[model samples]
Target: MAYDVQSAKTWSPGDNAFYLIVEGTTQEEIKEYWEQLITDGEILQPLAPSQWSPLYGMLKHQFGVVWALSVLNDASPM
Candidate 1:
């Protein structure tokens, strides 16, 4: 079987590893995306409000690797 390497809203492929970052003005969008990922069995972790903040959360899907997600209050850094 072929392994599928997918990423949740917060996850991305970089640094030779999979990382998740849920930021920007799309917290709700990201949450919905994550919900879909869970429903699809792509993610094995439940997202908790405390995982990151009331505004966001971070988690690794299927591997407990690590990911970051949160509300984007400021964009000056970018």
Candidate 2:
């Protein structure tokens, strides 16, 4: 999905205004993808356990896109 960062006063380009979530079945799967995205980019939040999932993190890709990666764990509803 996408968003118009200009319309959101709290967000701007290169920020976590829009997140492309990529959920995996295992923490290793998520972590691997997270590592690939962080290259030449920035990490908004380090991968770690969260209330919603076993492993979760947010990061900006090298191409200025944001992403939210997580492991599909029991804690998560979907």
Candidate 3:
């Protein structure tokens, strides 16, 4: 099977380099997962969260990809 390029966005210094963002159930688990990804060299740099209301983090992956993972509340999807 072959896939066609849908859309490609240019990268800028201000733009995060994340390609994949995986959401976890809890903030703690998300942090742990982020650390694990770093340990495995999946992410290069993890950004500092500017706000506490939303649990967010940024990391540069080994593949030169950047990712942002967020832990949403259980009722968020609903």
Model 2 residue 55 distance off true place after TM-score fit, in angstroms: 0.4
Kindly give the stretch of ten consecutive residues in candidate 3 with the minimal lDDT sum.
1-10
lDDT of 2 at 40: 98
Q: What would the TM-score be for candidate 2 when compared with the true structure?
A: 0.78
- For each of the candidates, give the backbone clash count: 5, 0, 9
lDDT of all predictions: 0.49, 0.81, 0.57
- If both were scored by lDDT, which would come out higher, candidate 2 or candidate 3? 2
lDDT of 3: 0.57
Q: List per-candidate RMSD values in Å.
A: 9.0, 3.2, 6.8
| Candidate 1 stretches greater than 4 Å from native | 1-18, 39-54
Quantify how close model 3 is to the true structure by its C-alpha RMSD in Å. Answer: 6.8
Give the number of colliding residue pairs in candidate 1. 5
Candidate closest to the true structure, highest TM-score: 2
Instruction: Quote the lDDT for 42 in model 1.
Output: 44
Tens-place lDDT per residue, model 1, 1-78, is 112245544434552155456554665776775664444244334455543344555445444445555555544233
| Candidate 2 C-alpha error for residue 4, in Å | 8.2
Candidate 3 regions exceeding 4 Å error are 1-18, 40-53
lDDT of 3 by residue, 1-78 (tens): 112222575555444433566666777878887877675454433434434324667566565556667776645552
